[model samples]
Target: MKIKKILVDSLQEAIDITKSTYGDKATIMSTKIVKAKKWLFFSTNKLEVTIGIADSEDFQKEFSKEKELYSEIENIKSTLKDVVEVVKSTKQEQKTPPPITQVQPQNNEDFSLRAMNLATKLINAGVDQDIARKILEDSCGFDITIGRLDLKYEDDYQSLIEGLSKNISLKAINFSKNILSILALVGPTGVGKTTTIAKLAYMYKSQGFRTGVITLDSYRTGAVQQLQSYVSLLEMPLRVADTPTRLRECVGELSSLDIIFIDTAGRSQYDSVRLKELKHYLENVPSLEIALTVSTTTDERIILDSARRFSELGISSIIFTKLDETLYPGCVLNACIKANLPVSFLTFGQKVPNDIELANYENLANILLRGLS
Candidate 1:
């Protein structure tokens, strides 16, 4: 077996380097925290991971061997059991009294049940329990008096949507008015920021706006080349910004264009150094607008944290990406409400220009109340 140790600032970075270096057969042997050079005037803890892999083809081939039908069936059964367990756990969570603050009358059983049911739906859709309860109390709270209930629209889909959307802040970008605008997208890794940037660039280019894209994702393998491919197909200008100086030059070169899109490297939300580095790079660009691209598939708490930190970098609006990958799309509402920022766009798929749209906050509420529309 061949063993190697990798030292990186974050565990995710170590795992990524391992996967790209040794592929599937690599086995992580051990991990430990190590003191790293001081950063941001303080010492940051870094992780050192030790990994091992079989050195011989014969040993490696053992893993590549196909499983028997019996083994496959057993694996399928195990997976199905896991899914059932998850469903049961979720249902149990739904039944429990939520830990959210209650503002309405506690004595009214009927009112409490109705409010709890609505809050449960939001929770199932990945909305934070506290925010969901607030929505129930503030927007959807219906009184069941001795004779009449004012919430006749409770059964209506449109009303539910309007209620949830009203609880959060939403902003729509006017692409036509973004003429001569330079926008930058920053987010965590694997959130489809690059593809979304390409989609926006193409959409504007097709609309007869001279749209251009500049990528600062120089560290990722083939990042520049991928965006360059789209630039060639669209016959639009593409620039690579490796330094703040180069970024300024790229902006000047594309200054006459109707829209300029800056594509930034995806960094872990915990990696504050790189986030600061991103800010230092873009702070010079004139009238620059920053958008945070986040994924609905991400854990709700992580989405909240990501939004908070990225918002520190002056992200005016958010773009929720990979909407098609998650059933619980409430991350949009959760981030917007918690971070107190407006969502500007939504990308559902990998298709260029077609999969992205101006974000619909009501659609989020609609999906939470009912299924996808």
Candidate 2:
């Protein structure tokens, strides 16, 4: 592990300095506030931070274990805090949930006649419960807490779809007006990022754009080869870039083309180190617009979290893939509502050019309606 101590005026400055020196994987070993008398009546407080970056895999493993231990400790503290809150509020607030007697059918025959309610449909369609209720209240003004709410789909379906697609933003892919447009796709592992890249490549190449491909995907096994196969089929030149300097060279080499598609390695959203490393490479490429590729099959919470984590690297838009894998792709709309990022393209199947389509207000809302309803 490499350890370094930096002095700065504020904590945020210390963080920036440490990140620039050691990437996002650096651990803060300690921090000290050093007070100094600058003049007879003046004094200044300087922040001293010690940061450590693991140099090897074993060191990183040990650092992870330590982080987990501290996380467990924090969780225990949080639980105790919650317990105290519960004890203090128990006597003042006695709001127990009502019984399940209402959901029970008077007879099994009545149960057979029952159907799913609006709330259940919203939830079963993979929309977050709170978000669905909020959207309903905002759009249709539906009171969800009134009894079983009768688990049945009704006229509110249009209102619910409107709520999901409300204020939704959609960004179009660059068509290369003057200078070459460099588009990159980034996301966590196994979200079909490379496949999506291939899809976009084919989409542009078919439009008669002079296209080129550059890959920062040397870390993944067979990643380069996979992209190579796609570019080969399209009869376009492919370049491999392993470092930031190499990426600049590749971009410059392909500047004469209409569009240069950069395929990046799939890194974990939780891995701050890899994300910052990817950001560093992107900073070298000018006019670079990146789309965060996410899968709709993942949980809504995870989808939102991935969006939050990757936003640090500066995402221009989002590309949702693997919509056919789940019946309840409402999570996509859920993320669109929460993440505040526009959708560029959505891929439904693995058929390269045939499965993807540009996202807009009508189609985005209609896709949710077609699947959820």
Number of the top candidate by lDDT? Answer: 1
Q: Count the backbone clashes (under 3 Å) in each candidate.
A: 0, 6
- Pairs that collide in candidate 2 are 115-151, 116-151, 116-152, 117-150, 117-151, 117-152
**Model 2, which residues run further than 4 Å from truth?**
1-121, 133-165
What are the lDDT figures for the candidates, one per model? Answer: 0.78, 0.76
TM-score, per-candidate, Cα-based: 0.65, 0.60
Tens digits of per-residue lDDT, candidate 2, 222-277, equal 88889988889999989999999999998888888888889889888889999999
Shift in Å, residue 259, candidate 2: 1.5
Candidate 1 local distance difference test against the native = 0.78
Q: Write the per-residue lDDT of candidate 1 for residues 161-199, one digit (tens) a residue.
A: 556666876676655544578889999998998899889
User: lDDT of model 2 at residue 146?
Assistant: 47
Give me the candidate number with maximum TM-score. Answer: 1
Q: Once superposed on the true structure, which residue ranges of model 1 sit more than 4 Å away at CA? A: 1-117, 137-154, 176-179, 370-373
